[model samples]
Target chain A: MGDEFCSCDILHENLIEIVKKKMPQEEKLYDLAELFKVFGDTTRVKIISALFEAELCVCDIAVLLGMSQSAISHQLRVLRQARLVKHRKEGKVVFYSLDDEHIKTIFNQGLEHILEPRGFEHAVF
Target chain B: MGDEFCSCDILHENLIEIVKKKMPQEEKLYDLAELFKVFGDTTRVKIISALFEAELCVCDIAVLLGMSQSAISHQLRVLRQARLVKHRKEGKVVFYSLDDEHIKTIFNQGLEHILEPRGFEHAVF
Candidate 1:
């Protein structure tokens, strides 16, 4: 299986060179991966999804997802650290929302990939 | 910490009701998180980034990323399973490219998020 999938020879060194030059710095890519890892959790995704419709407090997110407020708060901290979601204080209450439109766009783009029909036959690597 | 961050009361039942009605089914959200989880890996993100530049064979990808052919192949399989990437056979070599434009858009959106400056004060909650 490995032999069939991976050739020892560099098939296209020219293309590789070009791509290498254009690729983002390793540090940036690492940060990008970390950012996606934040979204990779079910609880955080639910919080972001709920916030997509309306700004939400921790208690509200917990209620919406049928989870405890403490659990919701933990995920909110992750989201905030990644800067995917931000919060505002209204007196004693705090409302959390997507930091910007890019969160919604990123989520929708993934949804599009999931929703789109596959054009090619599934290959076993 | 928990008390300050998470209120016991449902602050916005009306807003929760609206978001609840509009939220995608839980199963769909689960699938969405799974898709993001695929993007969370550094190797997979690097592979996707390279493919963004041009379609290339596994060996080419392995060369560009300075990783072993077997490691690249493993990541390729995960990418293929998630439908984030597609492969085509050209004679004896197999070339992989992103599954669609959505993949690029998703990656770019994440990039935008990382690049954008935080507008709000970082909250501790």
Candidate 2:
């Protein structure tokens, strides 16, 4: 039944089963894709990366990026909808930071790999 | 000179310097975005997620995802160009896996944070 994949040097049955257990259907794939897409934007990534160290209000972010307050606010809205970032209100100012630590770890790990070179062998496909 | 950003409460001067050290110009932000764009695909993400576990040949990966070898190959190509995945040729078979341990660590940390909830607080911004 799944011979085509086997013949083409793709994945085998065991791998299919394993992937299915986690993703179930292709929709889950889309879901995952959308999540990554959020990080694919420069403005968003900048905001996220900045938040990695300290929480900042819109004004601070704007000053940091040399952008306008409106521009920063708009990007913040998109990030909030994606659940990638969250906001807190203090006095008349609002500060934004990562929604979850999952995101922080992901960014940190990626940066770590980019900065460090080791353990990544040119073995396996 | 940077009064606006300070007024908005977004980021501070120090963050701008740090981010600038890595990204330099806005163009670097675009380059980074393009890199993340590869992971923005479900097929690619699944492929990456799978590679995180075991190094599977194309056929094995196809079977695992119940996808066509052609589809898997195409996605693999994208990953390869992005330096996200690398291939190894052994006789008539080729295996593919992540190009860096940084990617693996990123994924692992993301999963860790998603699966476990701790150390993340609703403080600061």
Among all windows of 10 consecutive residues in model 1 chain A, the one with the lowest summed lDDT is A1-10
Runs with alpha carbons beyond 4 Å of true place in candidate 2: A1-31, A90-92, A117-125, B1-32, B113-125
Where in model 1 is the C-alpha error above 4 Å? A1-11, A123-125, B1-11, B123-125
Q: Estimate, for each residue in A1-125, the C-alpha lDDT of model 2 and write its tens digit.
A: 55563454432555656655764245655665776787778888888877876777788777777788888899898787667778889988898888786786666555544445334452336
What candidate 1 keeps of the native contacts, as a fraction, is 0.73
| Model 1 lDDT at residue A18 | 90
Model 1 residue A119 distance off true place after TM-score fit, in angstroms: 2.6
The DockQ of each candidate is 0.58, 0.40
Strongest candidate by lDDT: 1
